[model samples]
Target chain A: MHWQLEIVFFIVLITTAFIALDVKNLLVAVVTLSVFSFISALLYIVMGAVDVGFTEAVVGGGVSGILFIVLIFKTSRRSSD
Target chain B: MTRKDNNPIVSLLSRIVSPFIMLFALYVIFHGHYSPGGGFQGGTMLAAAVLLIRLAAGREISQLQFKKSWGTPVGSVGVFIYFFTGFLALLMGGNYLDYSFLPLGLEAPVTRGWGILSIEIGVGLAVMGILVAIYDDLLEGEPND
Candidate 1:
């Protein structure tokens, strides 16, 4: 069961990572990156690194996501690349 | 471009919610030794709580909660605290970060535990301050400039 859950999380993590890179809209990309962080945190928790998982969830998903969104607001929404 | 958000719902809800988040952050920091959370997670949560208010309310109003200028200084102080703790151990005839010699009037293990707790607090404060400072800096200047 744990292995199955880990596999599912890995799938979601990779998918979000690719979407975050591929998405043209910067805001959507930021949101996708947040999702990626969340999944990675879950993976860490499953692996029993609770402290690392907690930090990843709060810092990576929460603070970094907010910072990225604010960055998007301050700059252009559309990516040149 | 620090504009006050006019949405009453967001302002009201965040105002109500931020304090609880901060309380939880403190809990996480204090209970880190026995739990999954620690300085970094708690500090980020603390910063998150403050930023929630900043984003929901306007920059001006949020300043009442946490001044914009306080971030970097608070972070500096936290780093100082960590360094001072380590230096104190060195002065007391131990290696750097050797908390057993802290002269806290406790058993060696307990002294080390206290030392770890103090270090976690310092790290938490530093993380909170730096993260908030980053947010403040990112929001500076005119949007679309």
Candidate 2:
């Protein structure tokens, strides 16, 4: 395990998580969340859990992104809080 | 969502890419036993392919690809396939989901492999159908304007 690579991934993961939570626009938040998911999937792969990484990449990054976008369109674009 | 505007480029690009995604999804499902990827991941990919079209084109146009009404039934059939496999093993005097007595006329190991394959297929289908169904249901009540 390359600790350096892992550290870099962790940094990005934390950054994206913060961005996702802090963003006011729900669409940007959703997209950032997708990026966060993809990065975590990468971290999973780095840790040698290939199957879990594959699942995270597919469901978290792809399908959930679309679902969240649909939810935004159906409900509201901006978060009230 | 209804067609808000026409963008041939988006529609055409998605049309071009969706089939390849589906093909890869099938590959993932079939090779699940030997690979890191499996039924759920592959099934989600399939749903993604279908949803790509639905998002690019409008709902009415995309219905030609996958009817909204067919989702729940397809999911049910997939579940039946899964349960029937297990129950067939049970009825054959083996424990539930025991593949040795599956009557495939193959060696024990080979029959076990076949059993797992069928289970994966069922899971893949069920996941794909249910996901698409969720997407459809989520958008069903939206007003067309």
Candidate 3:
């Protein structure tokens, strides 16, 4: 059971990172990154670093993505810089 | 959206979803001590809530804005807060991030807990602010954005 959970989690984690990388739209990418963070947070729980996981979830999954989206709206999506 | 003004779908979804998001973030942050989360996770979640507000309300109406103009300063201050608080611990003759030597009521469990919590809060602030700033900076030079 534990092994199955780990397998599922690993798959989720990998997929999350790829979603962040694969998404073309900047906003989507940012959102994917947040999802990635959440997966990491869950991974942390599995690894017995509950505190670290929590931090990762909130900061990485929650705030960072919002910041990205806001910036996307304020700035252009073009990659000049 | 501008057209979503009378849209029950958008309003209803946001009403139900947003509060849950915010609450979950808080829960993750608050329960961090005993569980799989902490200031960073919690703080980001908190910031996410703000971001959600920004998204739904439109940039014109800021629910909890730090402002693009002040992005750099706000983020920097958040980082400085985290470091400065840690520096305080160092000033009391402990190693960097050495919570045991924090001057918070003198080294007992209560003091130690207090010290750690303070540091976490500072880190949370920094993480939220800096991430927001970076996002703004990245999107700043885009055209037709």
Candidate 4:
């Protein structure tokens, strides 16, 4: 694996994680969280764990995103704090 | 989402794509032993496909595709399948989940392969059903604003 690509992914992963946390809009946060998950899955594949990457991509990015969106719809979309 | 908010394009496209996602999920499940994907990943993919339709087509329409009431029963059946496989092996003079002792009338290696496949199928079904069930329950429990 190329170190350059790994570095790029790591940067994006960290960026998304922070954005997901810092965002005030719950929907945006959830979308960013999904991005974070997909980036991490890419990192896992780059690190040679294909199976782990696949699971992360499917569960973290897809299922969890839907669940979070449903949650946002159920409650308030804007954060109180 | 409400019917008033439905977009025809999104509905059509999701309906078209969901089937292919399901097809790929099945492929991943069956080829799991030879590939990077297995039961859980495949099952999640399957649920994603179903959820896609649910999201695009609204709740009432999607019910015809997969009823919310079916989710728990499907999950229960999947668990039963997994348990029965293991128990059958135990009853046939082998350790629990020992495939060679299964009454498949095949060679040990082949029987083991079949056993693993069956296990994978069980796991896939269980994961798919439970995930969808969770989604359904969450939506059903949502408070009206």
User: In terms of TM-score, which candidate is strongest?
Assistant: 2
| lDDT, candidate 3, B1-145, per-residue tens | 2233544575456556777877876676566565666677766765665556545554445424447566556557767777877788799898887777777676467676776676667666666666555655565554432
Report i-RMS for every model.
1.6, 1.0, 4.0, 1.0
CA lDDT, every model vs. true structure: 0.89, 0.92, 0.66, 0.89
Residue A34 CA error for candidate 3 (Å)?
7.2
DockQ for candidate 4, please give it: 0.84
Candidate 2: where is the Cα deviation over 4 Å?
Answer: A77-81
Q: Write the per-residue lDDT of candidate 3 for residues A1-81, one digit (tens) a residue.
A: 367777888898799788778877777778777877887788778877766775676567656566565656566556687
The sequence of per-residue lDDT tens digits that candidate 2 reaches over residues A1-81 is: 688999999999999999999988899999999999999999999999999999999999999999999998888445487
Chain B TM-score for each model? 0.93, 0.96, 0.74, 0.94
Reference-based lDDT, residue B132, model 2: 99
Q: Write the per-residue lDDT of candidate 2 for residues B19-100, one digit (tens) a residue.
A: 9999999999999999988889998999999999999998888899999998998888889989999999999899999988
lDDT of 1 at A74: 68
Candidate 4 lDDT over residue span B1-145, tens digit each = 6335779899999999999999999999999988999888998999999999988898888898999898888778878888999999999999999989989999999999888888888888899999999998888854321
**Candidate 1 residue-wise lDDT, A1-81, digit = tens:** 499999999999999999999987888999999999999999999999888888889988899889887877766545588
DockQ measured for candidate 3: 0.48
Docking class of 3: acceptable
- RMSD of model 1 against the true structure: 2.5
Q: Where does model 4 exceed 4 Å of error?
A: A77-81, B141-145
Ranking by TM-score: 2, 4, 1, 3
lDDT per residue (tens digit) for residues A1-81 in model 4: 579999999999999989988987888999999999999999999999999999999999999999988887777545588
